[model samples]
Target: MIPLGGAAGRVAGLVLAAGAGRRYGGPKAPVFLGPALRVLRDGGCDPIIAVLGAGARRTRAVVDLAGVQVVDNPGWAEGMASSLRLGLSTAARLPEVSAVCVHLVDMPGVSALAVARLLAQAHASCLTRACYDGEPGHPVVLGRDHWAEIIETTRGDQGARAYLRRHAGHVTAVECGDVAGGYDIDER
Candidate 1:
């Protein structure tokens, strides 16, 4: 497992933009969400690495966020696991990152403060997740120490579900009084 605070001792944001978006018919990463770039970026987090796959270039083309790095995941077509792995691996390498808060492009409404709160709560209680009002949601925060544990069970688009399912006991349900936690554009 990646030891807590073993890296640069700060959090790095991982924006999962590598999906093929078969239903959306194009790259969803470049899809604009208000004034912010399609790739999620927020306070207290280091640079965001927009993991790209399928239409890597096309999705990244429209993102105008400065200092945002784009990393291609060859395994993206294989599934979401590859993108997760690629993102986590990149987070592991950053000199200033000790944790990763995963944000999905489709869920653009999740606040940066919500993510920070989860991380803070986890560090205090040794928790791994802050479920959004009893239901799990995006922007799952993982301490550096949990990296190795997650990397082992992760393989594809399962995203963080595998890790969350196995460690359900470590999850803390949180109520943020916000709809972003419950909102998902793709949900029908």
Candidate 2:
């Protein structure tokens, strides 16, 4: 199903949808990039958890399509770091989730296949990041080992970028040959 090696192990799809979207003045996750797409609709990357804040209700409603799990971030307004912490904390508890692909909901072009590939690559290589477009993007395939560190840094604006930089040695870049892989549309 997930394309990972050997046993299924545990892997998670962690969607970050908690931003305030100050510029767009609304929730970005709900933007209908393409609800009809087959890859996102049928890929079956489940336990699809979405971290929601700011416009939590709206985001929940939009991404909740077909029953996706939504986790509330109490300190989400603090920044992406808090949201990341909330997500990783929840992901750490899933028994089948040995790895996590941190996703940005508004990265509309990201497909479930890319996510599966990253998840598989993480297990095969035992690494912590799945880069795209020559740069690190969403769906960062974090191995089971990095859960502790990700959960601990839950304050201010501290984010995964710093850690990604520190652990650059274990990163793997999977180019989808698409700019959408590197694009970040934050209500703009």
Candidate 3:
């Protein structure tokens, strides 16, 4: 367990890495897991949790997940929602986690700076997302208060888009264009 935060807040990094990466020809988790973990760790997120499915076994064999909590999602083939649900559930179980900064395994361009920017704004009810040039992107910070609703609303590959859209008035968009690119790797 991570040390509880004093006044700022404690945020956990949840990496959605269960996809089989059909477009990229294989699981990107094995190739990019380390970078994802590094981004989260360097950004100040504690008690990180990585959810794996498709290549869970291979990813475990190739990736060094020391000090990081790993969760295996058996329903990954259904879509990214499964991974998000599993990751969120795991985060909710961590008593010290006030918020979760979600990162994608295939998004190599997302840097620690972006994650830090988002995490800096974390609060018990804050809903923040990293946006590049006004474009909403990864490393979305969902406070613990909203975990249950997000888990209930997210479906398929939509992730938390639907919830964010519905609550745009409450969501904070942190500009990270200077620190990271929002593009995700979809092909070789």
Per-candidate total of colliding backbone pairs: 4, 4, 0
Q: Name model 1 segments beyond 4 Å from true.
A: 1-8, 32-40, 122-127
Residue by residue across 84-122, what tens digits does model 3's lDDT show? Answer: 999999988888888999999999999887888887788
Q: Give me the overall lDDT of model 3.
A: 0.89
**Residues 43-160 of candidate 2: C-alpha lDDT, one tens digit per residue:** 3445666777777776545543455567888788788888888887887778777776677666766766666566556552355544565666665767778778767754666568
TM-score of 2: 0.82
TM-scores for all predictions? 0.81, 0.82, 0.95
lDDT for residue 98 in candidate 1, whole number 0-100:
63
Q: Distance (Å) between predicted and true CA of 149, model 1?
A: 2.5
Candidate 2 displacement at residue 99 in angstroms:
0.6
**Residue ranges of candidate 3 with Cα displaced over 4 Å:** 1-7
Query: Global lDDT for candidate 1?
Result: 0.64
- Give the top-scoring candidate (lDDT): 3
Write the residue-wise lDDT of candidate 1 on 1-188 in tens digits: 12223223566667777776777776676673322333234435566676777766765565565777678887788788788888888887875666776777777567655665655544312334445666667667776777776777787578878777778787666555363454655632
- In angstroms, the error of model 2 at 126 is 3.5
Task: Please report the TM-score between candidate 1 and the true structure.
Answer: 0.81
lDDT of 2 at 120: 57
Off by over 4 Å in 2: 1-8, 32-44, 62-65, 178-180
Q: Top model by TM-score, which number? A: 3
Candidate 1: deviation at residue 172, Å? Answer: 2.8
